[model samples]
Target chain A: MSGNENREKYKLNVGKIYEGFVIDHIHAGRGMKLYKDLGLEKLDCSVAIITNASSKKMGKKDIIKVECPIDRFDLETIGFMDHTATVDVIKDGEIINKPKLSLPKTVKNIIKCKNPRCITSIEQGLDHIFVLTDPEKEVYRCKYCETKYGEQ
Target chain B: MRHLLTPLDLSVEELETLMDNAEKIKADPEKYAHVCDGKIIATLFYEPSTRTRLSFEAAMLRLGGKTMGFATADSSSAAKGESVADTIRIISCFADIAAMRHPKEGSATVAAKHSRIPVINAGDGGHQHPTQTLTDMMTIRALKGHFDGMTIGLCGDLKFGRTVHSLIRALLRYKDVRFILISPDELKLPDYMTDEIKRNGAEYEEITKLEDAMPRLDILYMTRVQRERFFNEEDYVRLKDYYILDMPKMELAKEDMIVLHPLPRVNEIAVEVDEDPRAKYFEQVQYGMYIRMALICMLLDISL
Candidate 1:
């Protein structure tokens, strides 16, 4: 095969969407988690998650292609899940915009408070909310119990 | 509606106003006797804390308001798995305000979020007890005339004493306030607290022996050091005596110095020292009620 043919064969498996979002450079093996966290599986639109894709910046990366309007995406979920992931908004089969992601100030119903003494533990229908108390350390505390995430 | 989940929930100015009102209520109780007439306060003790529940009830009763609600989880709908949000929402329909003490940290905050009426956090596990901190502040201001320029020596269990941590945070807002933390190495104030003291430009010294800090202190706040907090019996025996405030250690303190404790203290402060005139822990209880009275009036937007 020619070099051009070889490059084409190695290209990403997913096709571009007409007007949707392309989440690129997700840390390898995190694309599925990002998909689940964003609740993309519940959406009616088509979504493709490519794992261990070749990358120059990263040794390997994951990419998510969603075939839906940009407004339909919850970008905050992506920011909370993986701030390093770059989000490209595609329009008419062209990359329209690449939005920067930063840690969200607060997240709702994403992470549960593990502290057994937390009110959320016994409450029947309480949302597990966390607030970013220390942005530098990326520390999140349960909104109800103020228990640091992953603390014993 | 307002809620006192933590001491920091009230700004410095608001605290001043609350203190001023508390003093006024202390001076002439009759003037504010009927300020909260026809009002109701629900004492929602999801955990059993008799002292705090009684304080809230007494505060409301003194203000001509009636009090209601359960004193323990088993007696309340919480035993049947009622959520804090739902309980508080239901309480709001009956009471003008609520005072809640829960075994879980941040439970009061959860109640406050859903309630239509104001919620005062009596205590929440080891998280916060804003009323206790407020009472401490009231006692200091009543005795010392102000919160500024005071050297406070906090002895015993600095690591897990919620009142001590809340008091330190509250006092850090004042000027020229220094902390002399006296605790064993194992129970030393956490690094986050010391860092917070430094970050706020407040001065503090951590020492193992309480006697060394006695002379320079304007106030000595004592908390019980539990036996289980130590890893072994030998360390507990060696360190237990150092934390106890007795007449001998009281001699090293300045004559005008006051001693305070969030009580139910287990022999940490000797009975002999209680007669020292400067032992203000009992008076601290009275101050707790006064502050709660002032707090309820303020939260209900009632004025004399």
Candidate 2:
């Protein structure tokens, strides 16, 4: 099929949700990981993922449609992961709210502590949390281990 | 108030007060011996440390306080998979204050979260060793009589040396303090440090040759270049003995230049150099104990 036809098919594949959230502007290949991080994969509600969607701003983007609106904590965590990602709460097939996207000062139960000596690495039932040390650089270090989140 | 997690937690006034108390205690040891009459300090050393733990224990004992707790995780419930949060919670019940030395970077913060009593971070891995920074600062303040207008030459492993990082941060608060970063290119100070120095508009130079920087230094802080931190053995061997302070190098330095080392050295400072009057690492050890004693009193809210 032609490129336009493929784009049409891809749009149809991501059917609208009656009530939920649409996480948009996700960097082209990072949608699945963000979906997993938000625990949307384990949800009983219907979920649709549109990968490599054409975008004017991002060149390419991914979108996630969850049949349930995510809570503020999860939304904030998502913003922390990818500041460009926008969350739109949908109800009765209408976009009701677009939550502000900003990096959180501290994130809980998101990035895992990879440092071997970190208490979270050795201890059980402890949530992995990170604190944003350098806001300008958007750098997050583990709250317990202080290990830079992305490097390790 | 209940925990000493980072140097930033203590304001400049509090730090000066701590140093003042430490000096007073040192001058008249008998007067402050029973200051902490019935108190107890728990030393939760998850890693093996001779000086830090002993300094803490000795400090507590000298204040007439009892010392208790494990030296290693293997001997405690930590080996059985106990969390730092849980351990600190349990330790809070047994001791009036606690001093913890952990291999983890922020494990002390984790312990502090659950601890009801005061928690002092003896040392945390490649992160902050606030107490040691306090010791070094106290030592400098004692010898120099002020923190301002000092040129510090930090040699050897700046990359993995937590003490060097902490000392630099602490000293930056003072006026017109310049840093002479002496290290091999492979083990240079991390970008975070240099970035911070630049942000403060402070002066610093990265020089590979220690002897070249020695003559201008008022304080030469030497750190061990550990073999384990390197990716390859060849690079480790090449950089390990990169900056040894021998007699000739010491002679090149100023007559009153203070040579400081966070000890357990592996020939980083030549044995012959220890006999020099400028070598103050031994005095630094005593200051470590006195500072901890002052810190324990300050944390527990006990008067002198």
Candidate 1 residue pairs in backbone clash: none
Model 1, docking class: medium
> What tier of docking accuracy does candidate 2 attain?
medium
C-alpha RMSD between model 1 and the true structure = 3.5
Q: Per-residue lDDT of A1-152 in model 2, one digit per residue for the tens?
A: 99988877766456777788888999999998988888877877788888998888999999888887445237676888688898888888998888898999999887787777566776667778888888998888888766778767
What is the per-residue lDDT of model 1 for residues B103-154, given as tens digits with 9 covering 90 to 100?
7777888888899999998887766789999999999999999988899999
Which residues of candidate 2, in runs, are more than 4 Å off? A1-13, A69-73, B227-238
Candidate 1 residue B189 Cα shift, in angstroms, is 4.6
Model 1: DockQ score: 0.64
How far residue B109's Cα lies from its native spot in candidate 1, in Å, is 1.5
Considering every candidate listed, which one attains the maximal lDDT?
Answer: 1
The estimated TM-scores of all candidates read 0.88, 0.93
TM-score of chain B of each: 0.93, 0.96
